[model samples]
Target: MATEVYRESFERRTKTVRYLRFLEGLADTQVGPIYLGMWGALAFFSYLLCVFITAIGFGEQVGYNPIRFLRELPVLTLYPPPPSAGLRMAPLQEGGYWQLATLFLSLTLVFWTIRIWTRAVANGLRPMVPIAFSAALFLYAAIYIIHPIWVNSWNEAPPHGLRGILLWTNHFSVKYGNFYYNPFHMVSIFGLLGSTLILAMHGATILATLAYGAHREIDEIEKSDEGTHRAQLLWRWVMGFNATAYSIHQWALGFATLTAVAGAIGVLLSGPVEPDWFQWACRADIVSGLQKACVP
Candidate 1:
């Protein structure tokens, strides 16, 4: 019976499966793998560029040679060909370019999500999960783009403009000490981590019990239903309460949305408003020795 089911699933998947189409394409065609490889390389290089920009910016502050250090740190020696001088520009003067690039990318994602939502609505296929998650991320991006303009004036503008807002919120500024102590940042981190964990659990549970061969059989829906029931039973055994699939969807969406919203709140409350996050967090100290040690 298991062998029959497995053969039927394999045949059906070969004919109908779209989820692994991209992977299949890469495996089947030389051009597909080359394109995928190029895209992967581009993504890696983009990350390297960002890291380079960050290292240069911070290196200027600490009077360290960014190029020499980056090259040597991996191999444990400073003896290497020198990097280009263009990348050695003063941090304050050139670092804002990286921020501009990042800001533009964030705005692009927000606009892209908006486009997706609009297209879905036009097609009468409104997916609440995508829209909700996109809306939350849009707000997160908006915090970076709008907060600096809203908070700072021309004379006392943040040094790196919008990026300065993120830098300070992340406690890159000395005044804030550490953003980990900030309640909102902590909440955001937990939300992000929790959402990831919940997503993994849901995916694992569903995949483990899915009736792959019964997807096209209306009468065989009992197989799918039974699998889902088994998954829910497993979840109940583990969690002590079985949420319906719809309820689980809602919980996943809530976790994802909260992650972005909490992060935005953390950014909004940083820098000038809450310069010393540690101090703010330690304001109402209960333990006497700890209080005196942290306090002035």
Candidate 2:
């Protein structure tokens, strides 16, 4: 009996290993092309889910209605249904599905980023860039999912989760003047723009090099190493960033992550926390007050 048990365990372990290997192989080929498609599908269904709920006028707790409960299975929403789906709240549907979908997407990204980071480390390449990107997504997801739970009245009025946070931003800004006036929001905006510019710079530089070296006949460039060397030299001379190209990605990742952090801080500031950002800025007259303070 002991021998039979040991044999079964060994077989199971072998099966597990094989299964993992097979999964790894599939991850390499299948995951690359289908990732964007999956994201698009999620976004589409999430929107559709919202429309379905709003059309039917169903709020949280389908409440023994089989059709309504069945509707819940299709799309995920981040907020509870508004008091009624019209006026300011018009077109908004509340449910946990959208929030759940965002979390799921973030988790998928984190997993792939970890895989890339690990492979980079094993191959003696810098892993922190990928790891940092993953960290940003994790932080963003955490802020979205955990904010509501932290608030006491998530299920009731004064929304508190992702939806609440966004609503607060919009509500406060409209009541005051502009969300951009908030310091944290300004920082987030800058970070977002800066990340985009950096990515564009990198992409354009690479494309320029490829364009410069291309030939009318494919054989002309493919058969010789000279064209490749010319392209590299041109890129170095024009961009003057050959050595630091690798570091650019790390910087971009850091900036992108900081954008998320800034947005989270901005959300906290705009909410009904200790001090309202718009109110404080307006009452304090920070700009004029600063000038007066400097008038020594």
Computed on alpha carbons, the lDDT of every model, listed in order, comes to 0.56, 0.53
User: Which candidate wins on TM-score?
Assistant: 1
Residue lDDT tens for model 2, 1-296: 55568656766655333233466744532122122244445545555554543334334546547687566644422454343422122232453443333445445565556556666776699777676665565445435444444442233223334345567556656643456667877888899999898788666655555655433224334544544445545558877745244476677887788788886676554444523454555555765544443322
* Worst window of 10 by summed lDDT in candidate 2: 28-37
Model 1 bad stretches (over 4 Å): 1-22, 25-103, 127-130, 133-136, 139-143, 153-174, 211-225, 286-289
**lDDT, candidate 2, at 13:** 54
lDDT of 1 at 172: 42
* Clashing residue pairs found in predicted model 1: none
**What C-alpha lDDT does candidate 2 achieve relative to the native structure?**
0.53
**Which residue pairs does candidate 2 place in steric collision?**
76-97, 76-98, 77-95, 77-97, 77-98, 80-94
